[model samples]
Target: MDKKQAQALGKLLRLSREKAGLSGRELADRSGMAASNVLRLEQGTIANPRPETLKSLADVLDLDLSDLYAAAGYIQPEGLPSFAPYLRSKYSGLPASAQRELETSFAKIAAKHGYDPNGPQPGEDETE
Candidate 1:
């Protein structure tokens, strides 16, 4: 990874870990990495980490592996759409109440179309 990309990835990793309520040591333990390694990765001291290391870090940080890969200057895998950017583009300018209203309306429409996001597919048997 280039210097800029590595720095960005480190920042992203730190943010995700904090958001997941994991300390550096906790994440290192979970991901089977050394605590110093985690700190160096987060501090941008290490560039071009192995893919497996990034994957393990993503798993422990509760982040998308593809996203971590992309941030590290790798190609995003095909057919894995990252919705976060799309969501931000579509909703970032809207007010909080408007965002909630839009989300509720979309949910209602999806429900009317037999889309139960939290439930099994329409034709799937739950017992299977």
Candidate 2:
């Protein structure tokens, strides 16, 4: 990862950890990784960490592996996420009320665009 991406990844990791109420050392212990490695990741010293390492961190932090992978730039960016989810992922500091408001507004816009929230999910197996 480039310097800027590394920095952003580190910040995202750190913020996610803090949001989950885990200290770096606690995360290390829970993830069964060395404290220094966790510190290095949060400090942006490690580039291109192994998938298992990211999985461990994600598990310990209660994050979806895909979300962690996306933040780590492992996945190709897709279409825009709904506003509430995008904000929650990138800005964990947002207050709950504000997030709910954005979700409500985004739901309205999506409905106007004919996106049915209750319909079969994208790529879902309809034959099941």
Candidate 3:
């Protein structure tokens, strides 16, 4: 996978870990991986984690291997070309806080285009 995909996966993994209330060191210990390795994984520095390592990480994180693989942008051996649509739909079902974070991220993006959080910018057309 490309760097962008790796980065996106890393962000998702980090968020999952946080939501699960596990520190990097704790996850590392549970997975029998080095703490630094776990940190690296969360930082997208380890783009291609080994299958065994992935499995171990998934086990500790209480995640299905398929979900982890999908997060990492890997196509299942016998399935679709992309799991993004599935992942997106699943992510949409997360808790309110998670949804708020997603909304905030989009708000930041919109802000860059001169749109205010409350409404349109001055002189901006209401309908495009």
**Top candidate, metric lDDT:** 1
Off by over 4 Å in 3: 79-128
| lDDT (10s digit) by residue, model 3, range 61-89 | 77788877887777787844333344455
lDDT of 1 by residue, 12-45 (tens): 9999989998899999999999999999888888
Residue pairs with colliding backbones in model 3 are none
RMSD after CA superposition, every candidate: 12.7, 10.6, 12.7
Best by TM-score: 1
lDDT of model number 1: 0.82
- Residue 36 lDDT, candidate 3, scale 0-100: 96
Give each model a TM-score. 0.59, 0.57, 0.57
- Cα TM-score of candidate 1: 0.59
Off by over 4 Å in 1: 77-128
- Choose 1 or 2, whichever is better by lDDT: 1
Clashes of 2: 0
lDDT of 2 at 29: 96
